[model samples]
Structure formats: structure tokens, C-alpha cells
Target: MNIDIVCVGRIKERYLTDAIAEYSKRLSRYCKLDIIEVADEKTPEHASAGVDRQIKAKEGERIAKHLKDGAFVIALAINGKQLSSEELAAKINDLGLRGTSHIQLVIGGSIGLDEAVLKRADYKLSFSKMTFPHQLMRVILLEQIYRAYKINAHEPYHK
Candidate 1:
């Protein structure tokens, strides 16, 4: 299986980048892992709803460019379904069994994902209802994916 994390903006923080690098190395044993960063749109401090929508749309366009038609897409959203680590492992396993070779997990910019990008997703996943910084989300997502692989292999992992 090939796993791709397609997210908006770059990780400028050293600690977050270190965490991401650590998980990426661990994931290398299970599958080929790729982290693709798209340019994020700058949002005004006091933007209206329409302005926010436009920002998301601009970021979505950049994200959409990286999404391959053959790849299974799972976009992260606040209202998305929340699943356990085991369930996520099962989902990945099942997708591979069904011949899905590529999986793209999307993390949106500061605002969120656009309607068009959400519509294109095969699945929408949520880590929590509370909003998280998109930069930190990259690390969290990588760790969960690595845990999923460990679970699928029936290997012991920290609960």
C-alpha cells in the first residue's frame, strides 16, 4: 500500500517536523509514505464567511491537484466519522484487499476543506470534535496511520 498525506501549508516548527519525521520513518516498514504540502492561502484576521469560503476554495484547488483519481481519498473534517485505531487498520486492510493501491489523507488549511474537495472524498475522518492546528494535525495523523499498520499486523502497540 502507498500512503500519502496531502496537506495545506508547510510545517515550520521544528518539534512538529521532528515528530512527523519519526512517524514517517516507522511507517516506511509497512508501506511507502509520502508527505505532500500545498501552499495555503493567507486569511484576514476579521474575514467574513464569504472570504473564508474563498480561502478554503483556493487551498482546495492546490490540494485537488495532488489527488489522483485511482487513489482512495479520506479528508479530515470536524463533522466526519470518528473511528478507533483498530477500525482504521481494518479499513486500510480492506482497501488493500479490494485492490486500492493508493490512499490519500487530506488535512485542510486554517479554515477547512472546500465543498468540492469534500465531495471527491471516499471517506471523511475526524480525530476529535475540537479544532486542532493544521500543522500539529500532520503529526497526529501520521502516528495514527503507523498505529493502524501495527494493529493490522497483530503487533503490540501502546494503547
Candidate 2:
């Protein structure tokens, strides 16, 4: 299986970059992994709702470019369904069993994803009701995916 994490903006912190690298290495045995970064727009202080929408839309456009045809998309959203690690593992296994060759998981910018991107998603996943920094979320998402793979393979890493 091929897994792609399409996100907004570059990761500047060294520790987070290192964590991503570690998870990517662990995931190499499970599937091909790609982390794609898109440009993020600067939000003005006290911006209006319309301005926020515009920023998300611009970021959404960049995200849409990397989405592959026939790839199942799972967008991260606060309002999305919450699943346990085992459930996520089952979901991944089922997708693979059903012949899904590629999966794209999207993490939005600080302002969040646009309606269009959410609508295009085959699934929406939520880690928690609380918000997280987009950069940190990337690392967390990678770890969860690695756990899912380990669980699916009956590996000892997922304890």
C-alpha cells in the first residue's frame, strides 16, 4: 500500500522533523510513505470570517493538487469520527483487503480545512475534540499510522 500525508506548510522545528523521520523509517517496512507540504497563507490579526475562508480555500487548492486519482482520502477534522488504535488498524487492513492501493491523509493549516476538501474526503478522522498545532499533528498522525500497521501485522511494537 501507498500512504501519503498531504499537509499545509513546512515543519521548521528540528525535533518534530526528527520524529517524522523516525516514524517514516519504521513505516518503510509496511508501505511506501510520502509527506507533501504546501504553502500556507499568513493570517492577519482580527481577520474576518471571509478572510479565513479565503486562506483555507487557497491552502485547499494546493492540497487538491497532490491528491491522486483512486486514492482513498482521510481528512483530519475535529468533528470527524473518533476511532481507537485497533479500529484504525482494522480500517487500514480492510481498505487494503478491498484493493485500495493508495491512501491520502490530509492535515489542514492552522485555520483548518475548507468545505470542499472535507467534502472530497472518503473519511474524516478525529484524534480529539481539542485542537493541536498542525506541525505537531503531523508527527502524531505518523505515529498512529505506524501503530496501526504494527497492530495489523500482529507485531510487538503496538502494545
Candidate 3:
């Protein structure tokens, strides 16, 4: 199975990028892992809540375009399901057995994901109730994915 992480903003921090890349490399042994960065919307001063939602909605559309047809989409949200590493591995294995060719994991920007994107996702996952920056979330997601693969393969890296 192939996994793709689609995030709204670029990772500017070198350390964060390096960390994500390292996990990506480790996950490649199990499945193809790719990170896709989308342009973030610029919010002007005194922007209304409605305006902000519109901008986030547009960004969500751009993310939707990158998704492959028939791929299972998973959106990272604060209110989503929180799964353990072992559970995540089982979910991945279940998807694989179900013949899911691609899995798209989406990370929204500062304001969070649009309602449309969340509605479209096959699964909504939450790492924690406390909010995280989008850049850091990418790295965390990558690490979790790597750990999941390790668990699935009975490897020692997950410990």
C-alpha cells in the first residue's frame, strides 16, 4: 500500500524537515510514502470569521485535487479518532487486505481543516486533543506511520 501525506504549508524548519524525511525513508521499506505540500492561504488583518472559513475551504479544495481517485482519504483533526500504534497497524493491514491502493493523509493549516474536507475523508484521526502546528504534525504523522509499519512487520524500531 502507498501512503501520501498532504499538508497545507511547507516545512520551513530544517530540523522538522529532516525528521520527517528520516521517517519517510524508514517507512519506504514497507510502502511508498510521499509528502505533498500545498500553498497556505494568507489571512489579512481583521479578516472576518466567514472570510477565514472561505479561504480554508479553498485550500481544502486544492488538497482534494491532489488526491487520487478511489484512494482512501484520512484527515487529521482535533475531534477525530485516536488510535494506538498497534491499532493503526491493524487498520493499515485491513486496508491492504481490502485492496486499498493508496491512502491519503491530510493536514490542514493553522485554522484547521475545512468542513468539506472532513466530510470527504474516509477516516478522521486525531493524535491529541492539544493542537499542534501543521509542520510538527507532519513529522509526528510520519513517525507514527513508520512505527505502525514496524509493528506490523514485528520489527524492533517501534519500541
TM agreement with the true structure for every prediction = 0.98, 0.99, 0.95
Off by over 4 Å in 1: none
lDDT of 2 by residue, 33-126 (tens): 9999999999999999999999999999999999888999999999999999999999999999999999999999999999999999999999
lDDT score for residue 143 of model 3: 86
Q: By the lDDT metric, which is better: model 1 or model 3?
A: 1
Which 10 consecutive residues of model 1 have the lowest summed lDDT? Answer: 150-159
Candidate 2 deviates by what RMSD?
0.6
Among all candidates shown, the one with the greatest lDDT: 2
Cα deviation of 29 in candidate 3 (Å)? 0.6
Residues 1-159 of candidate 1 have per-residue lDDT tens digits of 999999999999999999999999999999999999999998999999999999999999999999999999999999999999888999999999999999999999999999999999999999999999999999999999999999989888957
| 1 versus 2: better TM-score goes to | 2
Root-mean-square deviation per candidate: 0.7, 0.6, 1.2
User: Sort by TM-score, best first: what order?
Assistant: 2, 1, 3
- Predict model 3's lDDT versus the native: 0.90
Model 2 alpha-carbon miss at residue 24, Å: 0.4
Candidate 2: misplaced stretches above 4 Å? none
